[model samples]
Target: MRYRHILAACVCVTLATAWHSKATDDIAELPPMGELSRAIGPMVETMLNGGVAVGLAIEDVSGAGMYSHRADEPFVLASNTKLFTTAAAAVSLPPDYRWRTEARWEDGSLWIIGHGDATFHIIDGYSYPDHFLDQVAEALEARRIDAVDQLVIDARYFDAAYQHPDWPRNQLRRRYSAPVSGLPYARGLVRIRRGRSSVYSTTGDPIATVTNFLVRGLRKRGVKVERARRAGIREVQPPEFTSICRHECPWPLEKVLRETNAESDNYLAEHLFKTLGAEFHGRGSFDGAAEAVRVALDAAGASLDGFTQLDGSGLARAENGGNRASAATVTSLLRAMSKHPRGGPFLRSLAISGRRGTLAHRLDKGPMTGAIHAKTGWIRGSLALSGYMRRDEDRVVVFSILVNYNAPHTYDRRQVVLSFQEELLRAVWDHLDAVDTGWEPPPPALVQALEPGRPAN
Candidate 1:
């Protein structure tokens, strides 16, 4: 009976959402770019010849232009998945929605629930919230609560699957690609500053150091919580005396999203993926998040029939433990995100070429510099890039390009294949100006390079 009731409630919710989606369907019309396609055809062929399966999408924000090729296919999005996670958060959570790192007073004791916010510590000038424990204590004192008896921590929001099976075990040692956690703090990492004590030493000694704001805050609060501990514990353990009273909470949503996108943090992606369901569906299960994404895709009229998803973060997957999404579905989601009320925030969070985020190193000093804001993804042999591209005449273009099977087996061959795919995209962008005029005669060097039977660089 309860199941039936839940089903009925879901149906009603779906209908209401469907009507809402239908109301927003009248986006601006897209313009045609046939000449642009022909110009980019050879370049794409070259990538195919080099053994890459590619998916690409280009749509003008003004509703004046659009194009797609294999945009419907499923390719591992890698960190590009963070775009969806962040967008979903903006839609589900309030624009100013804050993930509270709460300090609770129970029986004259203080308990804190770790809500995963990655930027709660100082690294390279970015510091955790100053005097966080003092603020919590101040809030408590304002309420006339005199003291805390003990400390209790609740991190039951997410499950025990700290690491996904699809990920390489060695990745756990790295900060950028640490395993996901429900109550992650300080980016779920500790920086190890290594130096040589003496040049004559026979071996290099490395020291691992941690910057735990939560511990520091608790100590200041007259509460004694140990510093630089591992992620989880089976039972609560407080200090012998209640002499300390400081604790640390996570960072703000905007700052968290910025770090996740700019650095392409893998753990952040996983945590955000699970957070979608926790916020909306009342659960943090990966399946719940997958269902939310599926429902959204269905409402958008995109098909996701054949792909297999192993994990929300694209981490390693069990036989059927993960959920799947495609380039087409992602593009549609991006379009919807663009139309969302807080879409501007999501768009700006992406890395811009030659300026900030992952794109800072690539496309530097290129025409696309400062014109492209996108997320990037990479795995053993796959590469995916998708987001909004600022184009000629102030046009905003949405695009997704995935390059899979770049090399049959060899590593160098794979790099060449990936480079070919990038060239294809560059060519497509270059040909847009040709739309207002006929194709220009090929210059001598250009003619030879693009001649029939000529090899693609």
Candidate 2:
């Protein structure tokens, strides 16, 4: 009996030793956070010299940390808010989701229902199948309905609010801040071109604008109107209508996301926000959309602490405590997005560094060029960048850098902030792999090359 007990004890000891060895190997595989902190500490201090509140976080693909500095503190995110909005959208909305517009003939009138197709206008580079209204007219012609007693616009898929209350009033006329409507035609803007100059204008009544444009389009396509004065925008019951034809937005949801993130298109972002509300909560109001976004984030397993999202476009600053997010939150979001089933489309939609979108002018010429895919955000007193950095095919790093300032928004200040951002990125990239096996800290000469005094190559 004593010999049998001894053999059993030996077996248990061997198993315990194997488990201990595996744990040690796992620890050794993690990045050297201590050394990374030492390397990036000085660069961060220099960059934050005059900046008010700055937050930064860099972690490996699995949320394992390489370095973190005040990453838990929240800072104004500006357009970086699009990252959250778009990611949630990608998960909630399918890849094939398309904005649809439909026409129906009911009670001697032609009723057109708009589903918030933001791309109903002639976007320069994109190919839309004929004009949307023209397609409707063609369908009418095919049915031999040359004349109609009246035209009704059913635009109630979204709430009646034309613009968000938090948006800047003065910028309302600009295309970026154009009023959003359930029925957006030409992205809710009218262009007036005189001589060699062209000016853009926004309408307080989007329904009226769409109605007028449709009247002209129908007339041009040989559809007659018996009483043009009877046309107006209103909500209609779906059961009372007989569907005639449907027109889909030219681009898919993924392409729309690409435009939103790459160009920082505020209009598209807000439209998508309301669309999410319409999809989940059965209401397209801002409140409903905000709630839907919150729910989606929670479902995606994202940490919501220290984050406040007021508007999808990030145009609205948080009131007592405005739109704010921590570097850790943003980095974790990136990590989560990467693991999502739709993560590929979401990540591919981001602006590639120095290649396209808003980043075309940034990180243009460097070893880091094309190595980062991120979103850039800038508003008065705030600047932020968050995304993934690919050191190679095997190593991916997620990072977020947010800076807030009290200085006036001026050209010089903008330049200073941009320079600091560039330098900081360069420093991170230079020392990223230094602690890896067989690698040493970056040499002094290489470190000096990233100084702000040295003009970019």
- Candidate 1 local lDDT, 1-457, one digit each (tens): 2222332333222223212332222111223357776655545444443335566666554333356656666676666667666766656666666655555554465555555444444556745555465677676667676444444555546655555556666665655455455555555554454584322111111111122455556567655543333324455534442333344334456666766776777666677767666666666666676666556544444445544544555555333333335666666666666655555556667776677777776555567666666787776556778876555433455677776652334545444544554565566567665544322332232212111121112
| Candidate of highest lDDT | 2
lDDT of each: 0.54, 0.74
**Residue-wise lDDT of candidate 2 within 141-256, one digit each (tens)?**
78777888888777787888877777777877877777677777878888789899999888778888888987877887788876543233353354677788888888899899
Off by over 4 Å in 2: 1-35, 125-130, 193-196, 226-240, 435-457
RMSD of each: 15.1, 15.2
Clashing pairs in 2: 318-322, 318-323
